[model samples]
Target: MTIESVLSNNRIIAATQLKDIKRADESQCCAMILMNGKLSELMHMPMVHKPLFIHMDLLKGLKNDKEGIAFLKEFINPTGIVTTKGNLIEAAKKEGLLTIQRIFLIDTNSLKTAIQNIKDYRPDAIEVMPGIAPKIVKALKQELDIPIILAGLITTKEDVLHAFEAGAEAVSLSNQLLWNGTTEAITTK
Candidate 1:
């Protein structure tokens, strides 16, 4: 399914730790980004009902190559992946996994470079970090047509609301409390 469809109604995506998979699976979050774990941990990961996206960069012992992408598809069978590396995004796409390129808004030059890289790699979606930055989110939404997911340092209901107001399709957070609709902010149409 498309990331946009996966994030449609309740736009919160649980950015989960391996240990909290059960909670995320049961939460109101429309989907999940599995942000951390060992390669061995994933081998034994339980099957969950929701759409799952693994963060390739943080997966220890995974080579971050085409081979690694193949293994993930065969084993965990994730719906997609989140990564900062353009090559991994490409690799994941080649392996038929939906891709989300994580971009850090460090500065103007970095943002320019990231936009170019995003054009080149062409991931299914893009996740902008430091979700609190409304202006930056607004700017990026103006520039790109792909779905935008805001992540990192988004601590409260207000932050989630601001991100949506700035045009984020969804917000990914590790906060379990927020995963169950505590934020209660609907995306503005």
Candidate 2:
């Protein structure tokens, strides 16, 4: 399914990097970015009844290759995957797994490279890091047709709103308080 279909009404994803597993399991967000814990542990965790996107960078025992992508799809059984590697994203897509390519806008050069690479990889979605940059978000949105998920350093309601205004399809945040707060706001609206 498309990332837009997965996102649905929820414009915020619960990023479980530093989050307690119990809290993440009870999160109100419709999707969870699993950044910690082993694949075995994650499958057993009482997570919220939502789609889970495994973070490939944090996952162990998986090679970043076609065979590895097949293994992840068959064994891990995640709804999607998050990764910065262009090759992995491409391979994952071929494996019928939704791919969210993480792009860190460290500089103009990095942004340029990401744009070029994304054109080649064409993941299901693009997650721009340091989500605080509305201008960059706007620029990327203008250039790319894929869904955009703003992640990292998103700590407040204003930050989330700003990202949306700047053309981010959604925002991924690790703060549980912000997750609940955003859920309330999204539902109320």
After TM-score superposition, the amount by which residue 52's alpha carbon in candidate 1 deviates from its true location, in angstroms, is: 0.6
What are the per-residue Cα lDDT tens digits for candidate 2 across 56-120? 88876566777878888887677889999988898888888899999899899999999999999
The RMSD of every model to the true structure, in order and in angstroms, is 2.2, 2.4
Model 1, residue 28: C-alpha shift (Å): 0.6
Per-residue CA lDDT of model 1 for 112-139, tens digit only, reads 9888998899999999987878678767
Q: Against the unseen true structure, what C-alpha lDDT does each candidate score?
A: 0.87, 0.81
* Runs of candidate 1 exceeding 4 Å displacement: 182-189
List candidate 2 stretches off by more than 4 Å: 17-19, 43-48, 182-189
The candidate scoring highest on lDDT is 1
Candidate 2 weakest ten by summed lDDT: 180-189
